[model samples]
Target: MHIVVCIKQVPDSAQIRVHPVTNTIMRQGVPAIVNPYDLFALEEALRLKDKFGGKVTMLCMGPPQAEDALKKCISFGADDAVLVTDRSFAGADTLATSYALAAAIRQIGKEQKVDIVFTGKQTIDGDTAQVGPGIAKRLGLQLLTYVSRIADLDLEKDTITVERRAEGGVQVLQTAVPCLITMLEGTNEMRFAPLENMIHAARYPVRKWNKEAAGIEDVTKIGLKGSPTVVSKVFGPTPRAEKALMQSVEDATPRDVSLNVIQKIFTQHPTLERDILAKASV
Candidate 1:
């Protein structure tokens, strides 16, 4: 049960402040934390590792500072950590990101066969649950997203069974080993870091790989150069033109307020009264 958990370092939600002029997130001076959702994924992977008695590896793709995220996972009981960082990977969309991560996983797979890859449901910044699918597609690994519960894990048969969340209800799906799983948030709480794990994580020498080091020969497919969609601009949602106005009670009572509001609506637009009465009969 060599489980690999893919975690991400993200700006803390409390310190997330977008630059008004540049239309970009102000990451500078913002404290970073393990992506909230990824915590659940890591916890699940750790649980599996504990049950099956195998190693758990944590992988991340971000700036060098992202090593902190991996270290945090180590404190939670991951065996090893890998950091995939390259300037060429900047501005990468979900597709490009998946490509890079999958390549890194392949490199690590040569040493020890990775039985499973775990990820969160989605990222807070992107919120697009596409990277996991993209990674699975590239690696030819079975993808199971939005897993709410793990019904069973069979080491002998090399198979895993889980309860996945679908549009309407849960879908029980089974897949072979070497699959990718995206964990649903709130499924399991992260365990507290014990002293042993904390000591190891602090001194853990996380392996670092650049684009070429990860065996990404296709330079075109490595960064924003490979991304199909371009974000010309990102801004907050447009504000509404006007807010709803409340009607005060002239007679100082709930009944009076209701009556006054109705009268005001009718007086402002008499035709609205007829339409309301016609629909009220239904």
Candidate 2:
């Protein structure tokens, strides 16, 4: 069971800044951490690898600094880490991201068949859950998003059963292997890396791949050129209308406020008073 977990390095939301010229996220200076949701997927992959007695590999596509995120996964018990970084991969949206990830997985498959691929439900910056499904579609893998728990695993049958989160409740679905599963948040706690694991991560030689190295032959298919959607503008949050006015009464009795509110309402709409009086019993 060789499981591949796809993780991402994201800017700490509290430290995020937008570039004035490009209107893009200013990633420099701000510290980056593994996408919070990816931790759930990584932990689940590690747990499954522990039970099944196989290897787990962590993969990510981001700037060169993203190697830190891959190393962190090594600290959490992943056997190998692959970092795909290149200027060609910059400015990638979900569609382009999925294309690159699926390509990397294909290259990995050439070495050994991957049993499963794992991804987080969404990223804080993107907040779009489309990438996982896009990857699944490209790879022809079964797409399982918002999975809450692994109900059962049958190695012999090459099948996995999981409880998926839905609008009202959970849905139990059984799917074959070589599938992609996106773990839901708060499903499982991430394991703390021990002293030995931490040391291993510090010493691990992370594999880096450039555009050609990651097997990207088409220049237009790996970055913004490959993305279908374009964000025209990014704006600050809009303020809501309506304001609250509190009376300065010392007691602030409900009766007084209610009467005052009624007066104000009737003053705005005089017919409201007639309608309310007609409807009232007394």
Among these predicted structures, which one has the highest lDDT?
2
For residues 221-269, write the lDDT of model 2, one tens digit per residue: 8798998889888775545686565675676787898899888989999
User: lDDT by residue for model 1 over 57-130, one digit each (tens)?
Assistant: 88999999999999999998888999999999998999889989999999889889989999999988688988
Local distance difference test, per candidate?
0.89, 0.90
Against the true structure, candidate 1 reaches a TM-score of 0.86
Kindly report which residue stretches of model 2 are placed more than 4 angstroms away from their true locations once superposed.
17-29, 238-282
Q: How close is candidate 2 to the true structure, as a TM-score?
A: 0.84
Q: What TM-score fits each model?
A: 0.86, 0.84
Clashing pairs in 1: none
